[model samples]
Target: MDDGQPLFRWSWVVSNWDNDSPNSIVNLLQAHIVMSAVPVIVGLLVSLPLGLLCVRWRWLYQPVSGLMNAVYALPSLALFMILLAVTGAEPVTVIIPLTFYAMAVLIPAVVDGLASVPEHVRQSAVAMGFTPLRRLVQVELPIAVPVVLAGMRVVAVSSISLVSVGALIGQGGLGNFFTDAYQRDFYTPAIAGIVLIVLLALVADGALVLLQRLLTPWMRARRSA
Candidate 1:
């Protein structure tokens, strides 16, 4: 409407696509990908151990869950604003809060996955003389993979969405395009960025699902049987 042609024309998107400069579409997209992925990865590493600890000591679960939920409930914008003072608008400001949110989702998933294993299976492992660590690493973790991967899918998609919110702080991935378009009243970049982001989320979720299938072939076998 603003440009006389449709706002989301493919011709405009093609014209704006630049690969060489840091501000190019490709670079912005890469930045977005890195920004989204790093927090989730860090969250997974931290939350898995913490979730296991919570399982080991049931008393810790309530407190930890409460804390993470509180953190997750905090507005992302507010958290970014608060962290800006400490981190000075660096990428860490965005990554740190995103990591916290990722953990909030992941910890519960890990806990539920572990808890889903039948008590008899755990008992059998104990009877078979499996050490606590060995049972956890070899038996319990493997069985919990499907549920944990489900959580990872949730976190990954949400994180990808949230990366755009980062653009408000000048740290957004593909989200920057929306902000740019709004300010300039140009639709091509925003539309293209959104399409790419949706594709990325779909691809990420599919990969996680595939990984889940790979890790739990018995589930597939049982389904076929």
Candidate 2:
């Protein structure tokens, strides 16, 4: 209640959070999750291959990597606007720019991770007649998993915040709550939506940390020791 009434009126929001149905916060959240997941998955898929290519071809590394770095420097809102013009205020518009953004961050991280693999390990694998495919899967990837996961964690958390901007285009999410609340002059709901986004980000970050610990037991053991 801002000045005397209930601040957020949980009951009201709970009842009216959906796009189709009356009380569909569930749908709102689902839309956000789907929107966020698409770009993350697509970006990772695209970046991993490019990262590998960067690792394989030393000459092209500087220029290709520089391009990704430049893309990373582009403002998210600007990218969104450019996409909006082409895709025209649809979910695709949001996802395309977000995918590019994710790639900008992920490709560099993946390349760095792959580079961090010990030179001795690569030499040993090559000497053993391991095919490049086998070497990558059996030797290089395992060592790079922790670093890649760390980069993904950063992207996942960042995407949650960035995805909220989709609400500006009528795409649903906690962003809808925020946009609607502000338009309707309802501070409580707006605050509730912002709080929910923050909480969601924290939860996602915590889950990634847990996953890192699970996946990199050797690192955990060393740290504990």
Candidate 3:
């Protein structure tokens, strides 16, 4: 048995894969996915309406947008700490800060997307008896979908990476693997976690690219036609 301890052992991780403990790698992954998705979905819901409002009201463009820009500039860890203090290490603590992070990234993209809508197209929509809401819903939003999706892609990638910070507060994820590995000097699992996070980011990015292509086929057809 090699002195009753494994030399070059893979079983430490492999054997524990089916464990039901909160700290299990599978549990970590589930927690990470759940935590990250909460913020991205909530942020999108909150930001989309505000984004639409900003486009409709010129006054909101400066103050509200500027405030979100300020939030974006705050470091992720700092925001996390602030939320932790307020919410006391609960899941809501992490979710709230992450939502802010998502919003910070998303709101600007939404603004840019709306602003990028061609002036002529907007005018045409108005002349075609389209109400402002109808014009925004039908013309502006469809054209802006690519940019909005791009923002979501950015947030998804950032959230995956930022989740590592959540490990500091006893949260689970590949981040926990990272922290445990660092503490116990286990190099392989640490490297594995890093690789997994990177791969997740790449996969999310690729999926968003495919989605954009699928959603904007008219843009492709026009270029070819």
Better of 1 and 2 by TM-score: 1
Residue-wise lDDT of candidate 3 within 1-225, one digit each (tens)?
A: 235544334676786565977777677777777777788889999999988888778798889878877887887777778777788876677778789889988887898899889999989999999998888889998999888998999899888888878888766377888788778866656766777788877887898889899989987886899
Q: lDDT of each prediction vs. the true structure?
A: 0.88, 0.79, 0.81
Q: Which candidate is the best by TM-score?
A: 1
Q: Write the per-residue lDDT of candidate 2 for residues 70-179, one digit (tens) a residue.
A: 88788776777777777887778778877888888888888888988889989999999999999999889878878888888888888888888877777646777778
Off by over 4 Å in 3: 1-9, 222-225
Off by over 4 Å in 2: 17-23
Question: How much RMSD separates candidate 2 from the native structure?
Answer: 2.2
When summed lDDT is taken over every stretch of 10 residues in candidate 3, the lowest stretch is 1-10
List TM-score per model, in order: 0.95, 0.89, 0.89
Candidate 1 lDDT by residue in tens digits, 1-225: 454768677776666677565657878888888888998899999999999999999999999999999999999999989998899866788889999999999999999999988999999999999999999999999988888888999999999999888888887878888898899888888889899999999999998888888889988987999
Better candidate by TM-score, 1 or 3: 1
* Model 1: residue 220 alpha-carbon error in angstroms: 0.8
Worst 10 residues of 2 by lDDT: 14-23
Order by TM-score, highest first: 1, 2, 3
Question: What lDDT does candidate 2 reach at residue 192?
Answer: 69
